[model samples]
Target: MSEDLEFDCGGNRGDGRLIYTVTQISYEIKLILEDSYPTVWILGEISNFKLYNSGHIYFNIKDKNTQIRVVIFQSASINLTFSPKDGMKVLICGRVSSYPKRGDYQVIVNRMERCGSGELYEAYGELKERLKAEGFFDESAKKPIPDIVNKIGIVTSQDGAALCDILKVIDSLNANIETLIYPVRVQGKEAEKEIPQAIEYFNSNHKDLDVLLVGRGGGSVEDLWAFNMESVARAIFASEIPVVSCIGHEVDFTIADFVADMRAPTPSAAAEMVLRSRNDIKKRIEFLRESLNGAINFILYDRSVELDKLILSRALTKPYLIYEDKISYLDELDNRLLKSIGSLFKSKSENLGNVSHRLDIVSPLSVLRRGFSICFDSNNEVIEDSKDVNVGDDISIRFASGSLNAKVKSCE
Candidate 1:
């Protein structure tokens, strides 16, 4: 039976020969692998990992002694619980299959696990520690919230419950203030990057905003991790506009809280802090108006009293009283003038009598009364000497009342 089954087709029976074709051998190996093993687990270090655009992951798993090729379908790769990196030790569970055309074998992975805490989480922690050391969470950089803000910019999910609470509070306080909402992701992996970017965009575009209100409703720390991200903190600190961080329940605090201008216990509280009730302002205005009216009335009463005093004085009520006071004084002045004129006339009469008596005492006619004769020339001039008479000139002799005319005879 052994002799009949001997089939050496490459050479004659007496000569030794070898027979083989690449395609035939490969086909036989594929059949053996398909028939023998369904799937198996492989533990090795990953190498030459590639993610194709078609969503397929291709890689090589290598050990110190051997290595194997791997291909994970797009669906399976997407469902992977952890991200894998080159040189990472992992456990891959899949089926071994042979490629007839390439004449090779590869493992098609359905599941995989990292040797430790995984690549994605490791990167996250590393970045977080680096940012924390750089003081991204420092409180000194925080800004103070304005007591009254009429324009507020909000960064949160559009459909989130936090937005509803904020709106309700704002409406109750002051609805006149404008609120601008910027919708963004609030959770998950994308949130870590997108939330910060959204805040930065608003800061760059809306510089006129009075304040930024960033928040969400209550959630676990992991759920709110986006707010604690370094990018979010840096964005808040660098913003030119003030920020109000209201990122969960009262007990919650994030990195954003430390970097923002102020912190609110909740989203509703943040809204209340930014706006004041209209009733309060109205009450204040009413109080001021009353005080002003009271002051004006007091001033008017004082001025009225001054006017009454001025009217009662002599200068205002009686026009002729001032002239009556001066009339009596005028009579006294006339009496003084008459007495002075009378005294002056009497003194002048006495002086005239004295002068007349002195004239009589010195008269030249007194000499004639004493028996002395008076003589006159023809011209009525007195001839005192006999030698003054000329021959044939007429002369007059007077003795008191009588006079004699005589011709000038021979005079010795």
Candidate 2:
């Protein structure tokens, strides 16, 4: 598509102007309108409101003089904070485009806001900020989702599609999961109060549930307003069981989403996320079984190899040969011991003989045998001086092997 388009006409008029076909003109006008007003904001009061089952809203927005058809496709409509009614004032931002099927000019709205709902949005911001500052959305505060989920508690309207969708998904996965549904009003008066009550109900009564799913199917912002309430958010934050916020569609977000332990875009997705499929579980078991078998086989093979080595070893094969070798070693040790004892004894005997020879060289008896003698006086003491000799004194003289009694005159 170009800013300027050119086309061929079969023939020219008398004025020499080109004629474009209806389809071509419609396309040309669409291009011109889109190009001229790619983006615009309009203020008007809503009228002729129509919300189709497809989730698209077709309505007219007009002041007193004229009205223009506004088309809010499902993609953009789900984000609407308020449902458009016959007399509600609104502001919309959109692009001007031609609808070729109807050959009509319409505005394809991308954003819509209620005329006086700014304060509500402001309050929402304030609460979000407050809760965030208080650590309501902290990741550390979130509980872990159990790896295996056997039971779950749901907080939604019992008759809503969200429950059915969740159950359908669980069934498709063939998970043996049980559900405890706490029915409550998802929207309308007191819906916010009911939502938190339902959450608390499950928490207090059914503490054994593996996880809690608190949400509903896709809806307008007003419909999901219950989830955005502070009470609902706090309840989710305080839940002992892990909470999975499965509110609306992927593009939609609520305060519950931030405070929850986990978030799922839709109820069916929550089911798929929280519970493993039977086939997947079986595959996991099979993988573990194979791994265990491999480990056991490796261990057995290793032990078997060790056992074979032991069986082939000589220590086990030739018992008598080992005993014979031991006997031979003992004989050798005995001979070595005998030689050691004899050598020790001979060394000791030679040392004793040397000591005896040294003693004999200094012995008195040896001196006597060498012709040396000792004398004794009357008290059997040896006299070395000549002055005290008396004729009648008695003394004993020791010779080599005998002693003789003598007079003191022999003192000299």
Candidate 3:
């Protein structure tokens, strides 16, 4: 066997040999492992579990058929929740590679999961319960939908029946509302990442949208798993814009329904929920018009009645008669004044006659006629006796209308 495996010499050399270094051998093994196995999922029971002081985890995965060594780096090791025991079943996600120094193949685990019947479903339920207890489904966390939606954003698949249904509904009911579509995958492994990413994009970008409708048409639980994912639920809850979830049929409820601001049974129903019916608005306008017309007619009728009463009153019909009656009263007063003047003159003549009779009784001439005489000094005067006469004084005497003048010769 040694003679058949002899090495061939090509130039000057100490012996006929082919040389290979440790580093070169290890590099070739690394390339081969990377190219052949790549990344894969391995399910087996854990055995010979060990932890290094460097915080790395070393374990063996074994089945009845075969066994393989596994290593989880320190970064991934610290995040693991469950400890690996010798006989526990696990599913490891990792890349296959060979160690250079020891010349052995192992799996570098990135993630680990416990394997059992309905394990994925169990994980889903556990995560859901945990998030619910954290208040992710509280009513206070929900946003409010706008009353009059003008610009609407939709997150769903681009080539989906739900999109067409929504567009048709909006066009039939409220043609004026504008819609923006954000296309995303609706199912499969990529859906879990793409759907949530699309939701987050709209949350960050679509500030002008009145509301966002996030959903797809009806599907099975597995088909709708993307909407049930924690990533999608968080995106819906954290959205600044109000989200209306329309993910499935009326009977179906998803995590999105609990986290969204509003929920609709279908895409068409979501569109209808956003827009007001045209006939309803028309009926309101007609009712208001009728009320305005009725009010105006009532006011006009009241004003017309007041104006008719004013025109038909006595003051309006017989204004000239009121002036004529006033003039007749003045004429009667003038005739009465003339008759009073004539009566006053007659009374004045009678009063004057009585005054003359009274004056005759008290006259001085009457006293003279009674044989009493008024005496004066001798200048054309009558003497009462001889003593009133002076020597050479002129004297006068009168009786009725006759008079005599004499010179006094003696005085007694």
Candidate 4:
């Protein structure tokens, strides 16, 4: 073979030209793009926007003539103050680079700004006011959180730190409570859609849930944009289950916080609020037990004192003395009764004797006893007149104790 027809082992043909693999050429192109424009600023309208679950944002920035593909990685995107959406005019600062695999040029955005105003903040404010006017944030409409929750439905990213924090707090405090997690994207383009649907599902299917906690850990405004969405807010407002919003850190607030039944500063705080600590409940029960014991002891002591008083009372201790006094009084009455009866009998005897003496003085037999005689004619009637006795008539004379029969000789 000729020297020009032979391939050089050092990556060159017999010609003066160098040969490159597809990867080598792609890498060369990427290096050129990166070196040519290390950083640049562009003003354009956003289109074809998307936020992936990996926390990366992809979109196209277009002017009238042309458009360029842009990407914001998770690290840089986490620092963005607002979410980028289609049709929004934005000014972006980025480094130019190419995807070696696809051999495509793109801008890796590090910072972005709205062309006119803070679009996301303005939208947030406007929607908040409108929903407030519509009574979405009224305290009267908000459901009351139960003092004790049994089952809690959580709507958030399943693998996020927020979920872990909530579960850790709950487990530390109360383990008996059941947590039914309804996982969803907490932040992203699809997050707003998935969150509301999770809430509706819990409300429709798991009515047994005492409360629902919807939230995620601390993040940038763009990362937490899903919670600030109108759809998420409306879903929270419309939920039948009492919703406790735990989004971002203490200082970080979202539309969901206002629309929810309760707002917790953090995911751990939400767990603390929904369920009481096991130690706390045990302490309360112990307090009640002590109170009850105190009351019972007081009552028993009072009853014992009353029983002691009864045992020492005159009616109980000197019971026989009372009966003895009564007996003495009865004996006095009996003696008085006997004395009265004797006096009555003696007076009656004297009166009866006097009456006997008076009757004897007026008796006809008394006259006979005093040496006088009662004469009777033949008819045996007492002779009181001389005419009662006839001459030659038989007569009888009655003395004190004897009667004599004689002939009547004279009258009177």
Candidate with top lDDT is 4
Q: What value does the lDDT take at residue 20 in candidate 4?
A: 68
Model 1: CA > 4 A from native: 1-140, 143-148, 277-290, 305-412
Rank by lDDT, highest first.
Answer: 4, 2, 3, 1
- Which digits, one per residue and each the tens of the lDDT, describe model 2 over residues 1-412? 4333354563678888888777778887898999998767677889999999999999999989999999999999998877789988787878999987679999999888786744555677789899999999998999988888889998888999999999898888878778898888888768889988888888889999999988899876678878878988888888898999999877567789989999997999998888854456778999999999999999999999999999988899998899999999999999999999999999999999999999999998899998888877677677776664567787777878997887755433
- lDDT of each residue in 254-367, candidate 4, tens digit only: 889989999998998988888864456768999999999999999999999999999999899999999999999999999999999999999999999999999999998988
In model 3, where do residues sit more than 4 Å from their true spots?
Answer: 1-121, 277-290, 302-412
Per residue, candidate 1 scores C-alpha lDDT tens digits across 337-392 of 88889988899989999998888778877778889888899999999888988888
Clashing pairs in 4: none
- Which of the numbered candidates is closest to the native, going by highest TM-score? 2
lDDT, candidate 4, residue 346? 100
lDDT of 1 at 97: 85
Candidate 4: worst-modelled 10 consecutive residues by lDDT: 1-10
TM-score of 4: 0.49
Off by over 4 Å in 2: 1-145, 154-194, 197-208, 215-225, 234-242, 246-273, 276-288, 382-391, 410-412
For every candidate in turn, the CA RMSD to the true structure comes to 37.7, 21.8, 34.7, 33.3
Give all candidates' CA lDDT scores: 0.79, 0.85, 0.80, 0.87
Q: lDDT at 202 for candidate 2?
A: 87
